[model samples]
Target: MIDLKTQYAGLQLKSPIIVGSSGLTRNPSKSKELEEAGAGAIVLKSLFEEQIEIQANQISDPNDYNPEAEEYLRLYMKQNHLQDYLDLIKRTKEVCTVPVIASINCYKSDAWTEFAAEMEKAGADALELNLFFLSTDLTHNGPLIRDLYIDVIKRVRQTIKIPFTVKMGRNVGNVTALAYQLQANGADGFVLFNRYFQPDINLKTIELIPGSIFSRPEELYDTLRWIAILSGKIPHVSIAGSTGVHNWEGVAKCLIMGASAVEMCSAIYQKGAGVITESLEGLSKWMEEQNFHNIAQFKGMLDASKLPNPTIYERHQFMKYYSNR
Candidate 1:
């Protein structure tokens, strides 16, 4: 039998197929189904920082707050919601057999550390920090923003003993440097990129429209390129490809390009949890055909370093090819 087991961030997963943070994992029954269908790990739907703050704001009466007291009250509410998230981790761990990774997003370094500790105490197998900051302010330079990430990682690392990974957006100007800093700061692994929900223009209504609920198949290429580029560059850090991985072909490609694992969200949303079984089976069959018995044997085989022309990964070759035709 082909071995589907793979290592991710020092944790041995039953398979390389992880159910990325989504609503599916939030439901105990759906999470159970995903595990039954051969998922290696499950990332619970992320608890948003904004959501917690919103809840806190609603609970606090404006009349009850002097400016100083209001600030204190907000901080208290944020901490309280984080405790609630810890409760989620405990509850999910009690029912799930596979690794339960708690996810958190926050702007403050202190919040990240405190919540990470709470998650560890709640028995989370690992933590995935979806670190996000909109780089819209002119006063903040890349180095400053990068420092925030380092600080966040450093503070959180001190609090939690469990393995932790970071999910980052692609907006950083110096991605390579940031990735290196994050790894140096003690991130066990890094998910290549996180897709942001971009609002669309509804010309007819003259209103901003919500982004697509699902990722398109074409979105996989961006992740593929980065994984291939960063794989050889950051060999020690486990890279997991995410966004638009919808089928076995995409999963196999990610592993070949040096990804330790591939995360699936949109695909699982499009197809049911059973898609995990199909993906694993397809990967196994492909591996057998390729004469490879395990994931590591062929992982990163197609990385840029291994390519005859490394520049192909960096340049837009499609335009050249089509123009020549």
Candidate 2:
């Protein structure tokens, strides 16, 4: 039998297909089904920072300039929302054999992070911090924004014993440097890219509208390029390819490029849970064809550092190809 096991942030997963945090993983019943369908691990739907703050504001008087009441309401709202999340973790753990990872969608470091300890206590096998911040401010520079990310990782690291992975957006000036800093600040691993809410124009209406929320298979190339570049560069840190991994071909490519795992959200949304099983079967058949017995045998085989000519990953503009065409 081909060994399909892989590790992500020190968690030994049965397969490389981790269901990314989304509505599919919001309930215990759904988590159990995904596990049965052969998901290596499950990332619970992220508890958004906006959800807590918005609820708190509703309960408290914004006109009243009372710090004490504000603080109390913030704590109350956090706890109320957190209790549901903690319950989800606890109940899911009871029903499923795979690892249950708690997720937090945060923009800044604050008291809400202190609740990471509570998540661990409630039996979360690990934590996935979806750190998001896009600064359009004129005063903000890349370094300052990078520092803020480091601070958030540091705060959570101080509070939790379980291993945590940072899910980062691709908007930063320096991807490798930011990854290095986050790893130094106690990040166990990283998810290469997080999809943000995109806006589109309604040509007929002449107004802004929400863009397609789902990621297409073609979007996998960017994540693939970065994974191949960074996977070989970062030592002892696991990298998970995310956003646009839609099938077994994507999974095999990610593994070849040295990714420990690949997270899928849109794929699962478009296809049903059976997609997980289908991909795993496809991977096993492909491995047999390639004469590989285990994942590590071919993992990172195509990474930039391993190539004779490493500049292929750095080439941009594709002027030569365009000219020939």
Candidate 3:
């Protein structure tokens, strides 16, 4: 019997197949079923910081809206989300033995950050900060934007006792440096690449529409490369791959590349909970074939940082391929 047990975000997981935060994870009954289906952990659907802010424009005129009423409504929204989220955490913890990781979509380091403490108190094993801004601000330089993420982590790290992770966007530059800085700032783990909603235009109506939310299996290469690069470098920081993982091979490949774990949501949305079982079973069979008994045995076997030819990852000019061709 092979042991798939691995630690992620400072939490011990029975397997690496964590159900990433999405609409599918919001249901309590479904969460229990996912655990039974071999999920190591489940991240609750994210509560957005923007969700609590008052939509002041809803009122046609400034004079028509009562200032006190607007403030009350904003407070109510925040509290409502918190109350329901806390209840979900409590109920999930009761029904499932696996870790229940609470996720929050935060773009700033202010009042919204205070909820981290409450989530910890409410029995959340760990918190996953889905830190990203769908749009960019031209006024801010790269350093300023980067510092925002660090500041958010520092604020929440001071507030919560439970372990926490920062889920980064794909466009983050100099990832090695960012990972090092975030680890120093108090991030227990780093999830590579949070999938964002892709916007598209409808040619006929010229209206905006959403592109595919699901990640393709081929997209795994981007995450695989980073995990291979960062795993050995930041030994203290746990790495979990979020996008492009859709099968048992992807899970095994992630572990082999030095990821502490891999998260799956698109697969669940496409194939339902049985995908978890298929992933776990295939991983165990692969492990047995490779003469390994546990996850750690083969972990980091292909890390670029550990290799003599580490420059292979950085050489993206394709000169060698062209010459060979």
Which candidate tops TM-score?
2
TM-score versus the correct structure, for each prediction: 0.93, 0.95, 0.94
lDDT (C-alpha, whole model) for all candidates? 0.86, 0.90, 0.87
Q: Write the per-residue lDDT of candidate 1 for residues 98-152, one digit (tens) a residue.
A: 8999888767776557667777888999999998887799899988999989999
Runs with alpha carbons beyond 4 Å of true place in candidate 1 = 64-80, 316-319, 322-325
Pairs of residues at least 3 apart in sequence or in different chains that clash in candidate 3: none
On the 0 to 100 scale, the lDDT of residue 175 in model 3 is: 84
Instruction: List the candidate 3 regions with Cα displacement exceeding 4 Å.
Output: 54-66, 204-207
Tell me the lDDT of model 3 at 226: 89
| lDDT by residue for model 2 (1-325), tens | 8999998998999999999999999889998999999999999999888988788778746557588877887778878988988999999999999989999998878855677899999999999999878889999998899989989989898889899999988897788889989999999999988999989999999999999999999999999988988886777769999989999999999989989999999989999899999999999999999999999999999998898866677764365557678
RMSD of 3: 2.1
Better of 1 and 2 by TM-score: 2
